[model samples]
Target: MTWARIMAPLSGGQGDPPTIAAAVALAEPFGAELACVYTPADVADVMPWMGEGFLGGVQTTALESLKEATAVGEGNARKAAAASGYAKTHFIGLQTPVWAGLSAESRLSDVVVFTSDPARGRGPLAEAFQQMVADEQRPVLVARPGLKVGGVVAVAWDGGKEASRAARLATPILERASRVVILAAPKASSRSFDPNRLKAYYAARGVSADVEVLSDSGDAAPGLLKAAGAAGADILVAGAFGHPRLQEFIFGGTTRTLLGTDGPSLFLSH
Candidate 1:
């Protein structure tokens, strides 16, 4: 399974540069199209309450302001994409139904790319990031600064459905890594599994992986992070876990901790 299209959603702000650079880096290895989509706030979301009686001068000015902001954002996004100097890059500017356009682009792409800010739920595209991973169930690469694909890649495995799916979807990337390591913490997990099983699975696909069973220090996240850092992994492939709460979504303990880290980019699937 090779990636042919890499999607990066830009907010037309300071974050656009790193996000587009990351997308270009990921796409360079496979010669994939770097689809840089400009995602501005949907004006409809803000003007929904400005109907018949409320459509006064205030409403008119508000609509015009939103349109102007979108235009400015599009210009910024286009400039950022062009600055990347990637030959196969495509810049997409969306209309009023921005969310729908973003979803369609993400659905058609092999994987979505995001900067650390969006992954940490602290950026303009934060909501879009959540929707792509949890709601849309797309594979995502939460890229760090100076992103590179061909390096030591780590796989966090537990034999669960989520981990299994992540490992499977990340096969193409794993195949390209200089070295692959499977980090498993059996004591921290309630399930019974073998790390060598995953190692053998990768062997079938021409990826030689070493199995390392991490000492479960009560919580799994710390151990996993330590192991990945020790192995000098540039990317950690794992599953993103979340559940619906009363009015919000809460990420699982391990997933949350991993997302907060600074190094080792996360290649996640939910």
Candidate 2:
């Protein structure tokens, strides 16, 4: 129930601090530890064999760019941790792959916050970030580039174990929410559980709950986003999808799409 540790990735972008700050603010009330993870560039010791006509100058420039990027990333992470007044900050400069470093650190943390860099077009990093989300199987808070978080909250529910876990983890935040909405996405099955079952469950815990069932649609992200907007939800809580091994192999499409889409800050748990 308590957030003991928070892991945040740093990539030397201006957007990282706000994301980290939001997470620290959320965790500070609970006395959670903060850990900052940075991925350093991999500088190969052996230069690739090229013909005499090959341009060695281009290779040198690429190496310099890598070094500069790594340094900037490390500096940004440190600045963020210091500015946030995190009690404990762990800076990991790993020469290994980004995903490997993230996976290793994620295992040691209670939750991980993945922030996107607007300057860098969402590509491999986005994919890796989504993989981290699925791989960790822990709570993840994804902050949009420039979103202010406050007010109503929405919980995307499906009456499953993952949904239950998300609800439990979000209880602390939900308890303080002025309004809470539980969204149920129907599945294809012979028998389905009642959405009010979840609503009543939260009501019993002293939280005001509004339950709504979303019809089965090929695309749920857009509808969910629209609902959250209409509900004035500044924070969206949902369960991270995809099986453990499958997540490692193939990223969750819904999670990836959600991260990319605009709306409120997301609180996700697996």
Off by over 4 Å in 2: 42-68, 85-90, 95-98, 116-128, 145-150, 187-191, 203-206, 215-218, 242-257
Which tens-of-lDDT digit does each residue in 151-183 have in candidate 2? 688998767776689888888778777789987
Cα-based lDDT at residue 239, candidate 1: 87
Off by over 4 Å in 1: 245-248
RMSD of 2: 4.5
Tell me the deviation in Å of residue 124 in model 2.
Answer: 7.3
lDDT of 1 by residue, 207-267 (tens): 9999999878566888988999999999999988887565245789999999997879899
Q: Per-model C-alpha lDDT, please?
A: 0.90, 0.68
**Candidate 1 collision pairs:** none
Q: Which 10-residue window in model 1 sums to the lowest lDDT?
A: 241-250
Q: Pairing residues by index, what is the TM-score of model 2?
A: 0.75
- Of candidate 2, the 10-residue stretch with the lowest lDDT total is 116-125
The candidate maximizing lDDT is 1
